[model samples]
Target: MTETLASTSSPTATSGGTPPPEAAWINAYERLSPRWQSSALSPQSVIPIAISRVNQVDAGRLDIEMSAMLKEQMVKVFSVMKPGLLFQYEAELDAFLEFLIWRFSIWVDKPTPGNALMNLRYRDERATDMRGKIRTGLEGPGLTVYQKILYCIATVGGQYIWTRLQSFSAFRQWGDSEQRTLARRAWLIVQRIEGLYKAASFTNLLVFLFTGRYRNLIERALRARLVYGSPHMNRAVSFEYMNRQLVWNEFSEMLLLLLPLLNSSTMKNFLSPFSKDKASGSSGDETLCPICQTNPTTVYLALPCQHRYCYYCLRTRCAATPSFRCSRCSEPVVAMQRHGGSVP
Candidate 1:
C-alpha cells in the first residue's frame, strides 16, 4: 500500500497527464435516476461533453455534433474503464498486465500486431458491442454482464497492478521464459493478496465513512497522498473557493519559517489582533504606541482608548495592571489574540 501510493504520486506538472474518470464512476455509483452518461474517456473532457449533453437532453436527433460527441465519449468510457488500461497511477498496473499478456501470448499465441507486450488491446466483436451498448446503454438497462465482468477483471487486475512489481530489479533480471512462468505464479499469489487488501480497503472505507478519517492519517504516517479529491467533498464543483484555505496554509508555513528571526517585541506587533475603544479618545483616533509615543512603523497594538502600544507594550502593561486589565479602558482583558498585517 505504501509502495502503491509512492509509485502513483502525480507529477506536479498538470500539462500532460489524463484526468480521472468521474462521470463513469458516478453513473456506476448511482444506477437509478442517473443524470448523465458514463463517459469512457478523460474526466477533463467530460465538462464540455456534459454541457453539450445537457443542451441535447430532450432526445434530439443525432446530428453530426451529437453523434460525434456520443461516439467519442463512448470510446473514452470504453477505453478508460477496461482492465489495467489506466493512463495514470497505473504505470505499474499496466507494466504487470503487460507481463501477463506476454505470458499468455507465448506458447502458440503470437503477440498481436501493432501492440506492445506490456499493454494489450482487445477488439473482438464483444468488446465493440459492449462499447456500443454503453453509448446507447441508458436507453435500456445499466451495464450488461460482459460489462460487469470487465469491471470485475478491471478491479482485480487493478489491485494486482497497484503492486508496482515490474519496477523491481529482481523481476527485470528474469529471462523471457522464466518471467512468463513467474508471471503465472505471481498471478496466483496476487489473487490471495488482492483479496486481503480489498477486505482491508473496504474496512477502511467503512471507518472513513463513519469517522471522517483515514486519508489524513495515512498522509501523516505513510505520506500516502490522494490522487483525487476526498470522497466526502463536493465533486463536480469549483475548487476556487479553497483558495483562502490554500493561502492560509502558505501563510502559516511562512509564519513558522520566520518565527526564529522574530523576538517577543517584533512578534507581538506583527500579530497584534486587538484594538482600542474609540470613545475614549477625544479625536477618536490613534497614530502611535502610547508606551513609545512614536508613529507606527509596524502594527501598533491599540489599548481600549486613544492610547496605542506596540503589542509588547500593552501586553506588558496589561499584565502588570490589576487583574490584567487594559491600560486605556481598564476593562478586564479576558483574552487577547493576534491580528493585523504590517501597518507600514
Candidate 2:
C-alpha cells in the first residue's frame, strides 16, 4: 500500500552484488559451451531452450507474486461488503486462476528460445563486417518465422494488449456487468488477469533482457541525476511497515487516506467478534478465549495488538466501552480486518 518515491536523478551504476544480466548470461554460456561442444545439440540449440525455460520460470514467479498480492487486496477491499460471498467465489477461482496464470505465461514466454533480443544480443556474432557490430532490430534471414512471431508479440504486440485490456480503468471495472452472470464475469476477469500477467511478464522480460533491472520508469527517472534540468526529486514515499517515523503532516495524510475504510459499517461488521454462526461449526483449542474464559470456536484478531480472543468475547467488551480499544494494547481500534476462513 505504501510506495516510495524514487529520486529523480541520472541513474548511477547500481552497487548491488548481482552483476548485470548481460554479464551473468555471458558467463553462463562460457561455462556451459565446453561441456556441450561434442554433444549432438550445440549450445545455440540447447542454451536457448534452457534459457527460455529459465525465463518462463522467472515469469511464473512474477505472475504468482502479483496474483497473490492482487487477490489479497481485492479480498480485503470487498470482504466487508459481502463477507461470505467474496471468499467463496475466490475459492472457486483458485484452481482455474493457477491454470490461467501458467497457461498464458508459458504461451507468452515460449518465444524466448533463440531470442537474441531477449538475451540482449542485438548484434549478430556471425557478422565479420562492420567490425563485430551486431545488427539491430530483426535479424533478417537469420530469424525464423516462429521467432519473428514471438518477437512481434513479445515486444510490439504486448504493449497494445496491455493498453487495450490491462489498463487500471479496465481492471478497476474488472469482470462483467450486472446483466451478465457471475460465472461469465469471473471468466472475463480471468481472461483479463491472464492477459494482464502475460503482457506484464513479457514486458518485464523484455526490460530485463534489455536492461537487467527491476525498477520502473518512475524509479529510473528518480534515480537519474537530472529530470530535464531539475536535480533528483526527493521521494515523498514512506515505508510505514519499515518502522520509519513520520512527521505530523505525513501522519495526517495517512489518516485521511485510511479514514474511508475504517468509518464504514461494513468494516465494523467484518471486524466484529464472531456471532453464533461463526463459532457454531468451527472448532478450536481447549484454551478459553482470553477475554471470555470459554473455549471459543470463533476467534477475533486485534491487529497491531495481536491479542486474539473469541470474536464474541472481544466484541462485547469493545462495544460496551466507548473507546473500542484493543483489549491488550488499548490502541483505539480505528481499523481492523479479518484474515482467515475456509469456504465450504
Instruction: Give the residue spans of candidate 1 off by over 4 A.
Output: 1-142, 157-241, 263-344
Local accuracy by lDDT, each model: 0.42, 0.45
Per-residue alpha-carbon lDDT of candidate 1 for residues 1-344, written as tens digits (9 for 90 to 100):
34433334345423467653456435444653233354434253322101122112111222223434544554566484856545445454443444443344322233222222112222222222333333311122222345434433543464455655544433565434456777666655656776886787677656555543332222223222111112232223244778888999999999899988765554454545453633455543456555666655544444233245567665676668645544444445554433363322
The TM-score leader among the candidates is: 1
Worst 10 residues of 2 by lDDT: 222-231
Clashes of each: 10, 13
Candidate 2: segments with Cα more than 4 A from true spot? 1-142, 167-179, 182-188, 195-344
Model 2, residue 91: distance off in Å is 34
What lDDT would candidate 1 get against the real structure?
0.42
lDDT, model 1, position 153: 52
